[model samples]
Target: METMIGLPFTPKVLIVDDKPYDVKILEMKLREVGCQVAIATDGLSAIEETRKFKPHLVLLDIRLPDIDGYEVCKRLKNDADLKEIPVLFISAYGDVTDKVRGFESGAVDYISKPYEFEEIFARVKTHLMLRSLQIQLEEQNKRLEMLVEEKTKELVEVNKKLAMLDATKNELLQLVANDLRTPLTGLFSVLDSLIYEELKDQLTKDQLKAYDKAKQQMLSTLEDALLLTQIDVSNTDRVYGEIPIQQVIKQALNNVRPIATSKSVSIVECEAKDFKIFGDQNLLTRAFTALFEIAIRFSARHERIQLQLGTFDHHIELSVYVIGYTIPPDYIGTFFDLSSSARLNILGGELGIKPAIVHRIIALNGGSISVKNEGPAGVLFIIKFPFI
Candidate 1:
């Protein structure tokens, strides 16, 4: 009630009543308690006084000269800007129905016309205190919401920058891998020949054997690295064309023919005659080469390596099998992860020969590669490609 006790600003009150005596008594009572008061003789002028005074609270009488208090309360409550201001109904028509209608009209409280001075003060004090608390809570909530929204925006910006940095890092890795391409291929070809030539000559046979094996492993590893790099760095808009699976097999067989002869290894081709697949020819060629090379290296002397071709669900698949070696069960799960290259290199002195690169290339082409141990000593590498 003491509106300007410790502050310069005074809280204003609006009193609306048709009876002149009632209006004068309520105004004097409110001003006695240090609250600023405005008087409106009817419902129409009450709304105008509200706009002009912007009172903290409104005390309205049920009967008015122009309009009833219920209609006035409804209009005030429905308005966007004025709805938040609390209205207390002071009515002479003391009926349960009138009280219910006044509440339905959105007046926060209803007071009887033959009102007690103390009861009126108590209700006003209670409603004003509650309204002040509500205003404080709304202000606090708005501040909290603004803080949360700002933090969310900051987090989004940070995530965006992190994603861009990750993309740039991958691009740099691909560029480095591409630069290694020419030398790696040349080195692999030389290494393949080295193993074949050393095994032929009797003079440096035993000593050169390990070096030759190491060279072969290194070559294979490089090939894997190149393929993995292509998987990440190469454009996805691929040149899809007809590729002869048989020709790829033949070329791969020709490349490893000398090694097979030296080891007395036999080849069993169950390759589909004139079988064609729709994909990037060069990529398919590299995939076939890797499988064939693995088959040749791991198979026993004089043991037959099988090249099989088939189709399922409109997808073409090429499978190569070696008879003597089974992939280690412990290394089965991560057999195609690039990180496995480090493990393989540590174990066998060559990193590039790991299937990590082949897996990446296959995945990039929307294809998949898998291995299965058919029997005690049979290892199958199955590659599936889109029918395209």
Candidate 2:
């Protein structure tokens, strides 16, 4: 006897027939091939055995002693638990009408009487294989559903944690900004009053220069902190419109001109045909001002910085070349990350947070900024904005 392999388990078959010799032959052949066989001489007995055996396939004869095979198939198919089991009809009535009725009664296949035992075995094997595959598919689908449910729950928990962290961070930023800005504002008022000619005469040239530099650095740091907090908290209320790129650049230049002059770093602006981009004009100008200030601060005295603008296929490009300084290669990767220790160390004091602010502002306006070493001794900052 050849053992049936490759199935998840031994195939169980239910045979329903009135003939004793026919039933015995089929039962012997099924058992020889490692099938567990159950016999029924009537339709009701077949139904009973099917429920008890939970067989993989059913071989039913049309003429049953108690109830017809068609009625048995119908009853089995009506039961939710038994419906998936395939029923193959084996009957002496080998007519087209009988086969049609068998199919209508939910039989999977129909075979006429006087059929070869080999043909019967072949049909049984095919249906058993199909049942095995269906069981495997059902098992796999159940596993996948379970996995998806588990992952979805994990994602929900992660999102909740992230939301809590974000809220805490915003609250902290607001507190820090309020505490620092109040003192800085009062100091600026005192400094403005001290700028009067009568009061100014009290300080020497070196004293005045140091006082001015200190004031500028403090003011810059305060402004950057306040702006960063505003950007984080009020993103939804930003005013946006189409603004000319040249006008924005000009405004930024004017804003940074005093510092640039103080550092003796001249900026050369290259003219291009004006292009308009959609963004918050004030924010864009502030971003550009921050970039120019960073370039100016890092450049040597009298080093000329070049500003150029051009249009690409989908976006407008602005490039600033700081002629005297190049960022070290390692720091370039995390230059715009506010939390990066390297960036904090390199751009110390008031300038430390400006790049991160610039990056956020550009991102909010659907723009991007990047910095890289250019030529032998210069750093280049490239900014791209969507063309309107």
Candidate 3:
């Protein structure tokens, strides 16, 4: 007898036969090849031992004293738990009709007796190998199902944490805007009352100009804070439609003309064909106004700022060229970041949050904005929007 190697486990076999001499010989042959054997002398005892041993394969003899082997196979096939165990019939009847009956009763294979021991061992090895492969496949499927379930649970937890963080950020922005705007409104009313003809005559020319400048700065700060809060909290409620790019630029230039005139800065515009894009018209005007204000604030007296417009492929591009001041190298990367007040300090005023707000508005409308230093000329701001 040869020992089997590389099987998944030791095969368990049950021998069902009344002949003691044949059973003894077959049991010895199976044990030599690393099989665990259980013996049953009749059909009734075969069924009982099969349940207790839970064997991988069964070898049955048809001519038992009690119930026949064909009937025993039928009973095992009817059972939900035992139906998958492979059964082979070893009997004295070798006719074709007898073989058919054994297969119809759920026997996997048939062998006629007065049989050679070598042939019996060969058939037994084949069925045991097949049973081992079936068990291995079932275990692999169970492990794969468990892995998929674990990953799905992890994704659900991550999405829940992200939703909570977004809500907290919105609440904080609203609180800051409300707290600062209340005091600034009261101070603005006091300044307006001082502009009467009687009160104005008592002040010198320089004194009245300083008071006007202070009032303007306070009003601009209040407007920026309120708009920032609205963008963060209710930006989803916007009316989208087709907008003319030339019209949007005209509106922005008109809004910032007073500030540019006060600084003695000249805005030079290039004539180009009008282009159209899909977005909220009011929001685009606000974003462009902020960009022009920043350019005017950084320019020297009598310096020229240029606005150029062109089209490339399916996108419309707008470039704002400020000709006097270039951004410092260290602050270029974080120029549009929310916490970039240190960079704005170099410009002698605070304009950090305005850039962040412009970036958000552009992204919400499916556009993009970027700034780069243009060396001796100044800094260039480029904005692109899809026209289709």
Candidate 4:
């Protein structure tokens, strides 16, 4: 065969045979076909010549003056640096066993004693061409792997920048929500005073109800905004302590009494055992307040709002229920999601933080929350907490 494309560098051949005549014939033929040839009379010298010459191919005879061709081929293939140099066995022993042994010894193929130069040239050309393609493929794979690693690093940096931007936006939102709190507080104070003063006689029952509802909704918005700031923890890291659920409930009820009175909705603390859990008391108090506020706003006029606290499966179970409104079953699925609150038409006394902030506070305390609608009868908000 004529010269063909197989390697980036000039091909070199190492002929391992003790017969001077055999070595001379192969050396002349390989050189004529544009291959640089190196000679080794024994297996020991063949390995040495391969190292020095770094030939692209090796032409080995089965019988060497010292080590056999099988051992030489095995040694060449075992070496990480030399294994890619294709070894072709050339021997006078042309039995099936000899051919099998040659291949088992890592020879690419075996050639008979009275070898045809055309067969030699064809096998060498094919193996060398295959070897060159394997090397190119490995190089391409390494480059692809490196490219994937670089892209992964770039994605990590982008995520870090996005997180920083989110933190900045939350900070700005906290500032705005804080500024709105004071005026809403003042609005409630004035309304409460008016309904109790001499002007109380001048205001009709419906007008007083309107003022109360307005005050309650405004306060709900204020609390939501306030809770938004607390959600991220400001001085919250080291202030945890034991909090009695009863004490928290008492505070929430006291804060909610006026709203309940205005709506003519009655509230009662049902049968519950006293228990304590570890958490941030002030935050938990605000969380309970949000729960009560939601209950009061949702309860029908003159309806009963029942709150119960008990233990269940090593957990503190707190449930609030209103006698008539049935929360849609599908709404229960998104009950704790913040988007649900955000989508509410808040003017109808619906708060924009009910399950969102309420669930977050309980979750941060290592607890979980769930909701259920007892159709045609009532809706329940159940909050469970683990003892710290």
Best prediction by TM-score: 2
Candidate 3: tens digits of C-alpha lDDT, residues 1-388: 6665668788899999999999999999889888899999999999999999999999999999999999999999998889999999999999999999999999999999888878888888888888888888878888888877887788788877876676667677677767767777786677667664558888888988877766666667667766776776775778899898889888999999998998899998757566888898988899889888888876778898899999877789999988877777787787877777544564755464677778877888889999988868588999999986
Can you give the TM-score per candidate against the true fold? 0.58, 0.70, 0.63, 0.62
> Model 2, range 150-201, lDDT digits (tens) per residue?
9999999999999788878877888887887888789778876877565788
lDDT of 2 at 261: 92
In lDDT terms, which candidate is top? Answer: 2
Task: Between candidates 2 and 3, name the one with more favorable TM-score.
Answer: 2
TM-score computed on alpha carbons, candidate 1: 0.58
Write the number of the candidate with greater TM-score, choosing between 2 and 4: 2
Q: Candidate 2 — which pairs collide?
A: none
Q: Candidate 1 lDDT, tens digit per residue, 1-388? A: 4433432345578999878888888888888877899999888889988988988889998888999999999989888878988999998788999999999999899998798877888788777777777777888999999999999999999999987886677777676666676786787678667656654565466767776676666655555665565565446746767778787678767777887788788988874566776667667666666666666666878799987788878788878888876767766666667666434533253335446656765676677998877689888888887775
